[model samples]
Target: MIDRADFLARFGGVFEHSPFIAERALDVGAVALPLTAAGVHAALVAVFRKASEAEQLGVLRAHPDLAGRLAIAGELTEDSRNEQAGAGLDRLSPAEHARFTELNTAYTEKFGFPFIIAVKGLTKDDILAAFEARIGNTATAEFETAKTQVERIALLRLTAALPGE
Candidate 1:
């Protein structure tokens, strides 16, 4: 029930948590020695204080496996982009599954990370097609692509967390 003005004033600079959430997260992170879920909630509450639901999901949507096209190889992992995209296309209609299977293997071989994308709104075929198209991209190109995807995810999470945001 904290006011937006008060919350924003206290914490307004963060790369990850947006302005308000980041500040509270920092405060809670600074002193969670008591170790309670409430402490965690306090930190998260700051994130949600002024955000929309989509923004909140943005932070969690990131794909951890994709590498930054321009990022050091060291930064690459198994899941880099926001893994979620459109929701509920699990039972891919035959050809869709095959495409995903091929793309998944090819992408993993090329970049060493799962081709990640937000799948909340897209179909499995679409996600697989992106992977296929991206498989043809150069490492540097893919790295930048992944970075952009990550930013999108973060923004989504941020918007969701803000109270009236």
Candidate 2:
């Protein structure tokens, strides 16, 4: 177990980029760290390590569906997630919602994965706009964007849950 103080320290290593993530994530990781960043190098290494090709593709598909609900748990606060879910593409005004649904479905079909954006601080309109813009990308391009976005989300979650990066 990491000492409380030490675990909080490691969380920094996870999300070396982006302040928006910093805002959305709670500091519970700081207080709960020894248990949170519990695996030492293995955990951090898992974030950076290579995986089988299938696993790599799975990673691309791992994000929550754009209009799908966020996963609930005691480990994470429900309020924050409710806020995230409220930010869903389906909740937009009719025209914008239609646009978002069209883009989300098409993006999924073309990429074989849900479209992901951090969506933490973004408005519903902003997220839909991003989705529309991204769908124009080729499969190779969209894949990389999704991969990058997920890494950012993982880093954000890690920063919120672990200590000492």
Candidate 3:
């Protein structure tokens, strides 16, 4: 609906600090005018699916871990901050924080990427359970799983940023 530049500006971070997905979607006209959030998200998902393995990995790696260093440092992007906070990740008690830290370290060590989940409307318990369960996934399986989670996160962010879900 709006011009290309404006669309890019509004949805640039829908992919967790990545804008190339939006740019590519527009460049290829995968997303036309009369842009709805679902349309944009669909286009972006197409872009993501076509991305090289390394690029996909980069996108996954770009996300901050739940209740991890960036959240502790107060350096999470606004969307990430709010999402984590909504999940009560921002208010963890010391024991909970330690458990999360331990799980995060073990998961990353095992999977070669941070544990990722769509934190929107999830409880901290839910996240921890997911982390614990998903940590046992094989590397190839986990990679695909992480990418799926990233898409879910992008969809949530896009829904919030754009006019409709």
Summarize candidate 1's per-residue lDDT along 1-165 as a digit string, tens digits: 444465454333222334545555555553243323344344555445445645644442333332223122344221222333223333455575566566666776786555656544666556656776888999777765754554454444444444321
TM-score of 3: 0.95
Predicted structure with the largest lDDT when compared to the true one: 3
The order of the candidates by lDDT, greatest first, is: 3, 2, 1
Q: Taking the tens digit of each residue's C-alpha lDDT, what string does model 3 give over 3-113?
A: 878888888888888899889988888996566778888999999999999888888888888899999899999999999999999999999999999998898888777
TM-scores for all candidates: the values are: 0.46, 0.59, 0.95
Return the number of clashes found in candidate 2: 11
**What root-mean-square deviation over C-alphas does model 3 reach?**
1.3
Residue 124 of model 1 has an lDDT of: 54
Rank by TM-score, highest first: 3, 2, 1
User: Which pairs clash in model 3?
Assistant: 1-34, 1-35
- Residue 28, model 2: lDDT of 23
Root mean square deviation (Cα) for candidate 2: 8.8
